[model samples]
Target: MRYFSPSKAVILLLLTVCCYCTSFSQTEKKHDVIVKLNGDQLNGDVLEISDSTIRFTYTGEKLIYNIKKSEILKITFASGRVETFNAPPATAQTTPVTATGASTAERRNKVAVLPFTFVKDGQNAAQEVSDEIQNELYALLSKHSGVYTVVSPRATNVLLTKAGITKANMLNYSMAEICQVLGVEFIVDGMVTQNRTTQTSYGNTSYSDKTKKNDNSDDKKSSGSASTSSTSVQNYETTMDMKIYNDKSEIVYNQNRKAFWNTADAYKNTMEYLVKRCPLYKK
Candidate 1:
């Protein structure tokens, strides 16, 4: 039989653990990663590259993610392959310098809120609501100083008119083209739907009461009552669906939210919620 000292046994155990850790680390590093310009790294295995886009399935996942070349900084592969990207210089300034020689304080993630499409019984009301929502979005986003740069409704309308894009044909154009024409890094487009409803209800109640007079006479009475009523009014239910796309035309956010209130409140509440929930809010 062989006997080993305690110190020797402990040394052997540590050596074994070191070797195991090295092996595990090598195994974990066997994948590719896409590093974005903003310093975000997406770990995955490169699946395909086509049309200035890289498509890949994230490590240990089946879902695929596609990234535009313009947005990527570099790509590192498991097999020790490395590729660095150099984005071309911008031809035009996204946010032009001001008279004071100070650049706009807004982040690079500029956005354009296009006119909303409305679904309502009255055409005038629908137009008014759409205009109201656009104005509300501009007001809310602009107040969040430095968080986002929202294009003014007037500027957006002018661009749309120049592009010959009316409410009826706005959907026909592609998101990428819209982004280009707007000179923005992102596009915010959505639809507003209004639903009106009338409801009626009825109720019945029965009770019995007994009274005693001072002369020791007792009186009892039973009564039953039933009532029915009807009400009719226009109750506006607003459903707003918003979509945000990047300069590459990739969908960054697509959310649907609903609110029941007057036109102004509906726009205010829904837009506030969506803006806060948006990933771009704090980015």
Candidate 2:
């Protein structure tokens, strides 16, 4: 081997150091992923993890972010390690109501029907009727197979009640909150209106005065008169307004339809029409 000069030795050392540094840097590179409760994934490095928050930085960014632990579903490390986090309990105060509600991962193809708002004679009807309509709608929806999974009206009502939600105050909360509480991908809200539009009265009168044969004698000559009978019929016009919302709290369907026939229970027909035409209805 030939001996190298001072300058050549210095250059060789520098090259070796540079190659080692590059290899070390390559080996040190790491990527950590954060999965949010809303099913959003973030590719970044977890700088620090605390009891309530996590310090993170984007894949190529230098700035750090503090994310709430409650919002994170899991953290996957580049070393093939996964750490999971529990979702916080849902509560009116603790649970956040965003436009998209909770995680969108498992909510697909599920539906919930809420108690309908019933109006009769231009005034609010009884709650029982509203519940009746809800149950009826639920039954109709349950009949269709391979369309979607429908939550029972009883379960939906119980969840709403446990959350202190009622038709009277349902508007106070956003649709996303209700969707999260119900754990469904879609929500069905509706209103039924019935009004008496007309009344018809009909009557008929008959009289018989005839000379009968010997058997009946002159009894018919006495002239017996038949009483008049009258009947009153009330006609009602029924209309139904239906609205469907997705987990994102966006209104996907809004329609109002009136029944072809004016009857007390015409709302049933209108509701059926709307459901058949709704976007969620597969066939």
Candidate 3:
């Protein structure tokens, strides 16, 4: 009979323990599983639930993924928590704006839409955006009958110019000073911001090489090689903010909205959404 030494027994025990741990780690269960409406399953950890969206992270990956609630069928968590999503209604009810109007005394309030302040890197394009925002805001407000008497963009520009509000001196005045110069009890000021970014990624590559000998013989051969690749992704973001101030130079309403597209139509939609939600635009 062969006898094993104590040191040999200890070494064997350690090896067995290590092997067990490695096997357990390899077969560890997933933290959660997400079932998409399209019959796909994603195994990952559910990190957050907000904004009608779910943030999930795949096992062993640092990248986080976002899926809208509308796309998810259900989520099964490791701890036995299951969440289901119901399809959203096709048309949500639009509440009528019945109480957003000012009183009879307040209806006479005069409001001016000033040249928007541009927070950007370059001056040439910033000026254009500023002018566009000013024009759009004036147009929207002017169309709102009896909400507030809106000052025309042309007249507002003349008042600003006469007040020495050149590009050089525009940033030096306070909201009260601007209101005084525009001769209005309330004013609408805005800031426009745009951020654009791009990202590049590479996918798996495959290479193939082949060699053939000429039928005529000799020591000559020909070789051929081929390769394939994929494309990259690029994204952009833009944001705009609008604020309303009263005679006391206090903010009465403020809103900052952002969008992902960098096109003129996207900007227009953003402006529309923001303006529609303003306190003065109800009903």
Candidate 4:
């Protein structure tokens, strides 16, 4: 065993004492919940505490948390006030805004279209299709009188990207947040699949005896002599779904349409067709 000199022993003791003090100090601190599910958060220390709740600051205001409703994920306390741990709830909490006449009138018959998402197949093609569909949908909505105002694609793009949603497989925004942000009565969101190729061939020419035995007395005529080459042109097909909601944010109508484009001039044919045929036009 190695023994330390007197000075070295004193230094070691001091270090041990300091570490013990640090551990003791950490165990005695407590922090109030700073942030809540809603947009509310505290900027200052918690001033009061109870078995089930704590009071924290607002804009020079103080608010109380109902321990039952307030999520307690993780908390470290100061002798009683400063906290520094995240308490993210496993689920979301919705706080509805009561409808006043002013609020009701302000949101009357509004609509917003979520930014279209493209399902990436390890290529940029999907994004292109997403943009193409979104633009066409916007153009269609632009001409309608029955439809409420559509949220700008730029804003939708920002929100969608912030959510880390890079694909159109689903809309990640919750109904509450979406309606809250856009103040809309309806939201139209869905995916877009670009051009597809389908081929059908009739009379695939072959040299089988059954196809060739047209019993010429002198010689057997091969099926290749009667073979015909046929080809069909494939076009872009699109399917669209639109959803309408009432003030309560309940979906009232879900409309779907599928349209086909002509092979010669139908790169974006499906989107144009939906704009013309969508019921939103008459409404």
Candidate 5:
């Protein structure tokens, strides 16, 4: 067995104490992260956690901050433990209860397509066209909606009718209210305008002339037959305005597109273009 003198034993004790302090200092360096409900993150030491508030200090600063637990979304501790705070209840304007009593939180990742509003020559056309566009849009979205549940047009229309939400009265309700009623996280609304741009007329004329007396004389009598035909084509210019809103009534996407072609059903192309580029669209 090795025996150390008093002075050497004291030195070894001091070294062990130094190593322990170093290890403790390294552990203390690890930060605790606080995530706020508004999406802000704070990195620092958590001094204390009270029932309603948390005491914290910035990583490099000594000034302590006391944050209400209600404002914090969660906290990640240095030891890899996570604590989450309850989210504040949404208000009526932000997350209204639906007819089925489902809250907006229950509508995550769901989408609803509303009946389009169609106008032709500055006058509101029949609702038949609006319903047609709605069905078409619903079909397109249902086919390509990645990670989103698209409510069928039939179901959406039924719900809207039950809520007394027609194209004329839709504007009276907030987007959040509409989304809640449809039980969807997002809603797609569109308006199509079609106006006659120009009328083009094309004609073709054909004439045949025969000189029977040309064999006898150069300036003999001549007979001619003529036929003419004309046709008129009407060209239209179409524009589509598309908007997407979340359950919070925030507009996530808004775009106005004009059809590149001048045809009667040009709005179809414009509508497809908007859908393909909207935020919910995925490869």
Candidate 6:
């Protein structure tokens, strides 16, 4: 048997107690987290955080939510270490959990489509693409059985512009407004870009310092000037990024897709691709 001296035993006992105390203290320290919901921010202690949801206590209520990192306008940690988490899982939904067991069946059905933003950047004529995209979308949902029974472009445009979506969005709009625009159960909005170039020839000229300016101002004309023609085919380009929102104005889907006019069938090809990939297409 191994025996410890009196002093050694006392030291070991103290060390064990110290380690236990440190561990308990760490576990007891409340972990702070800030959550933003429906344009409201709440401060609370985090009881659990997982891939699908967060469990927190705030305002004297235990709340559970399905949220994306992007949905969180801001999150401040007690340790001051800021981190970005993943977006919500595709199947995970945002459902309001009521601690008081109250029913919420009277919410309005809202939706929106951000102005199909024109890809004005680079060499794209965003306005043209915007018009075309709007036309295509109009054509698509017009034929969908019940899709347009809720919202239309005319209505969406009026409502969206009122919500300050006159230009491209950098978080300038809200989900609730978007829901109102679409008129359906949700809303879809996105952006686009396109570019092309042409070849041309211009007369190049040179002049002598003394005689050219004084005598030949009218006589010099364009030395090699001749009637010439330039060719610039109408090339097209388009890119789109989209997001869907629920009545609460919470984001449901976010994705980006692109298209360009390289061949005669470019428009058809691009539209087909977008339709196949768009969530609205399936809806």
Candidate 3, 257: how far from true, in Å? Answer: 1.7
In the predicted model 4, the residue pairs found to clash are: 29-77, 29-78, 30-77, 30-78, 31-76, 31-77, 31-82, 31-83
List the candidates ranked by TM-score, beginning with the highest.
2, 5, 1, 3, 4, 6
Q: Is candidate 3 or candidate 4 better by lDDT?
A: 3
Q: Choose the strongest candidate by TM-score.
A: 2
Candidate 5, 56: how far from true, in Å? 72
What is candidate 6's lDDT per residue for 1-283, written digit by digit as tens? 9999999999999999999999999887555666453455656665666775656677456665455545664566778765545343443223221121212332233233445665443643556556567667566644542433435567656655554455545254455534433344666666555444443345545544433433735664333333544555454454556666666767666666556555323544555565556555544
Query: Relative to the true structure, how large is the alpha-carbon lDDT of every model?
Result: 0.72, 0.86, 0.73, 0.54, 0.87, 0.54
- In terms of lDDT, the best-performing candidate is 5
TM-score of each: 0.47, 0.59, 0.46, 0.43, 0.58, 0.40
Stretches off by above 4 angstroms in model 5 are 1-98, 205-226
Residue 101 of candidate 1: its Cα lDDT? 21
Model 4 collision count = 8
- Residue lDDT tens for model 3, 119-236: 5443335577778778987887677636567888888788776656755555566666667667677878777766456656567677676767677876566566667787765554
lDDT of 1 by residue, 189-208 (tens): 78776666553344545454
For candidate 5, lDDT tens digit of each residue in 1-283?
A: 9899999999999999999999998776688999998889999999999999999999999999899999999999988999889675554333223564677567989999998889999999898999999998888777888999999989988988878777766667888888878889999998999999899999999999987766666768879999999999999989999999998899999999889989998787887888899988876
Give the Å shift of residue 35 in candidate 6.
Answer: 34
Model 3 CA lDDT for position 87: 51
Worst 10 residues of 5 by lDDT: 89-98
lDDT of 4 by residue, 1-283 (tens): 9888999999999999999999998786344445555546444455565666765553445564334235443343434444533456544322333222235566666655665544332234546666766767777776773645666666666654544434532344455445555555556666553445565455555443443444556565544334556666565444545555555656766556555553523435555555556545553
